[model samples]
Target: MRRVVITGAGTINALGASVAETLEAMREGRCGIGRLDIRDVDRLTVQIGAQVRDYDEAAHFNRQQIALYDRFTQFALLAADEAIAQSGLTFEGPLAARAGVVMGTSGGGLNTQDENYRAVYEDGKNRVHPFVVPKLMNNAATSHVSMQHNLKGPSFTVATACASSNHAMGQAFQMIRAGMTDVMVTGGTEAMLCFGGVKAWEGLRVMSKDACRPFSATRNGMVQGEGAGMFVFEEYEHARARGAEILAEVAGFAMSSDASDIVMPSKQGASRAIAGAVSDAGIPLESVGYINAHGTGTAANDKTECAAVADVFGHHANDLMISSTKSMHGHLIGGTGAVELLACLMALRDGVVAPTIGYEEPDPECALDVVPNEAREARVDVALSNAFAFGGLNAVLALKRA
Candidate 1:
């Protein structure tokens, strides 16, 4: 099988506008969750979110592009620019034909939909923007990234709720490993912190009003966040021939579904995916030193994920370090796993484990080394990223230090 590696990574999230800034924030256990600055904030019951602040669309895009690109698309484009630049691979000629894009997004162009809905329903406006359909589509980010990067082969979007990014990235890894593509621009982006977006989630009653404290006994619920995390997944030999700086190796990926619940997570399904990822990587459970958990700060999710991890690794589970960056960046929904993957890279390359900030009193049910409150330095050879979404869709990716 062809080996896959990540040559470049970029992100524009609540923590920072670039990968460097984000890693720094993670190292310091900085909290990005704050009072959301969006339209009609007064109407929202849960007003706090990890919003990408100080972002001016005009600064990054022209008037025409802004009109056509929604917030999510814009975020994806910005992240892609950074990732592609770092990879130092210009797609042209045969390379362009062999390279493609697969991005994940749950609420694509949600801001666009909210605006149009307000104009038509609330404001009594008759017509909406002509490009609304294309802009608001789920594949808008993938389509725009492919066009901009000249990726002509196999480009699409994946939407599996919270696991969307992991699933999309896992597919990208498989495509390269299968020799179907030489390169893939894969990750996820979401801009769902708008008025309508928050309002819709408020109905779920699973959102924290103040802060996100994953795995903590005092935790209320998960917090919403917005941003993008993009990466360049390239065939190992191809990247080596070009002398590209590999961030980490995409060792293995596994996915499973609970087939039982639409909202609650299943430990059995999560454990299968986790164990399958390690087995597929050809690595022992003891080799994995860190995990970027899908700890949503909710009661059911935290305990369930911990139990799944314990079940999969048994004795090794106690030795592993698990932390949720969600406590710092909030939950980016579909874009989350991509951003959380950055934490794995940090553990593998820089030996710094990002903390599960906002954790106060630990829950006995989640009795593991969560590396809470502060970042820790530990040499790690292999790391895993776990994403278990609402639909019981679980995706796990194993990464080895490059």
Candidate 2:
């Protein structure tokens, strides 16, 4: 089997626009969750979100491109541009044919769908835009990325709720490992911060009114976030031959289904995924020093995730540092695993653990070392990023320092 390593990474989240800026925010334990600046805010009970503040669509896309691209596709392209540029790679010749793109998004072109639906139903409009179908499809982001970068091999999209990105990335890793592709442009994107987006989630009653305090006893619920995280996963030999700057190695990836609950997380399922990733990586459980948890700041998720980690790592769970960046960036849903993976990269690349911000009082159920409220400096050799989605889907990725 071939080895896969991350050659480049880029993201645009509530925290920052680039990997460097996001890492700095994590280092300072900054909180990006706040009152959202989206349309129809007055109609929803959950008014706050980790939105991409001060974003100017005109600045990123031309008029014709804007008409064709939705907010989610625009985000994916922007992040992909950054990742490809940072990798110093140009997909040309055979490389272009051998590379591929895979992105995860739960609601593609949600903003477009919401606007068109409201135009006909609420505003009594007769016609909607012609590009709606192309913009709103679940595979839109992946298609756009593939076109932009000239990737022609094994391109697709994943929509497994919160685990979408992890599953997408896991497939990309497997493709490279099996020698199907030498490189893959993969990650996740989300732009579901529109009126219809938050309104739909409000009915579920799992949103926090103000802050997203993960692992805290006073936690309320998850907060929505918007953006994209993109990476260049290259075969280890390919990256080394090109003299690319290796960020971290994609050690292993594993996925599992609970088959138990729809909304609630299952400890057994999560544990199996965690253990599967560790075993797939061929690393000892003791070597994993950090975990970017799927800590959604909810009572059930936090408690269940902690228990799963404990079950998987045994006594080493206490010694490992665990934190939920959702406390800082809110939940990006399908795109979350990709964004949270940035925290794992930070640990392996910079020896810094991103803290679980907004944490206040500790809960006995979540008694692990959360690295609460403050970033800590530590030499982390291995780390894991966990993502458990709404419908009992779980995915875990293991990483090692380069």
Candidate 3:
């Protein structure tokens, strides 16, 4: 078995295209969410989202590749490229065979699916795009990453609804720890800003009419978001031996399911996951510095998650700094865990906890140090990132400052 550490990280969301920009926005307590204007907001009750505006796909991909990739893959590939570049890795040497790619995405090629579905169903078209399979496949992003980088060790995709990214990263961590691979690119990508995709989520009737106020009494529901986040993970010895720039060490991970409801989440599931992760890391509960909560700003999620934390940590829950990044980037769904992981890493590295943007109104059920709409500077040794999905899937990962 080997130790795993993060060497590089990158992300593209409503906040910005890179980690630095995103962290800066979080530090300043900027809300990236706004009214949805891509098409129109005539029927949807909630008309706002944390949409990634002003991105040029051509700059990231060539004409041929651009035609084959959906919006989410484009974002994923771009983030992966930045991470690989920052890590200073090459396709030559043993790195080619030792490296792998792992990604999580809920609607892999939703934009492509919606377009082709409309063509075949609405227009009654005789023929559809021949490249649809390659474009719309859930594994397309992982396949493209392997092809682009010539990585042959392991390549796959994980789909666990909103917990997809965390599961992917956690799986990657286990693989590295067990010596399956030396280096891996793990993260998530999502593109649910499209009309059909957004409409599908609208059926749940949880869209925030105005904003996402996680842990707040006035909290309504989650807002749609689109983007990707990636991280380069390498075995600790391998990274140190090669003089790689170490960012943070992936300490522990745990996963569980409620097995009760599809939409409603459970505090017991959340409680078990936090305890499991803490136990897996071999760290006391008091060591956890900050938590990147799965605070969707929904009525059920905020309260349930709060109760779970309190149950697991007791008085330590009040002492810890917690925040919901979704208040700004909205919820990225399958790709959310990856972005939240970045928040965890940043918190551990800089010892500064980002705020839960748009947090207001005291919600007694969710009473905690939510870092309300303002970043706080503090000393942090370990950080936790949580992802609880709609189907009761929960994945938690802990990171130690390196």
lDDT of each: 0.96, 0.93, 0.89
Instruction: Sort by lDDT, best first.
Output: 1, 2, 3
Model 2, 99-204: lDDT tens digits are 9998899998899999999999999999988998998998998998998889989999999999999999999999999999999999999999999999999999
RMSD of each: 0.6, 0.7, 1.1
| CA error at residue 199 for candidate 3, angstroms | 0.6
How many Å off is the CA of 112 in candidate 1? 0.3
Positional deviation of residue 182's Cα in model 2 after best superposition, in angstroms: 0.4
How many residue pairs clash in all the candidates, one count each? Answer: 0, 0, 0
Which structure is stronger by TM-score: 2 or 3?
A: 2
How well does each candidate superpose onto the true structure, as a TM-score? 0.99, 0.99, 0.98
- Tens-digit lDDT string for candidate 1 (1-402): 899999989999999999999999999999999998999999999999999999999999999999889999999999999999999999999999999999999999999999999999999999888999999999999999998889999999999999999999999999999999999999999999999999999999999999999999999999999999999999999999989999999999999999998999999999999999999999989999999999999999999999999999999999999999999999999999999999999999999999999989979999999999999999999999999998899999999999
Q: Write the per-residue lDDT of candidate 3 for residues 1-402, one digit (tens) a residue.
A: 478999989899999999999888888878889988665467666678999988888877788998889888888888888888888877667877888988999989998988888889888998997899899999998888888878888889999999999999999899899988889999999998877888888887988878988988889889988899999999999889889999899999999999989989999998999999999998999999899999999999999999999999999999998899999888999899888887787788887788997776998999999999889999899999988998999999999999
Collision count of model 2? 0
lDDT of 3: 0.89
Candidate 2 TM-score over all chains jointly: 0.99
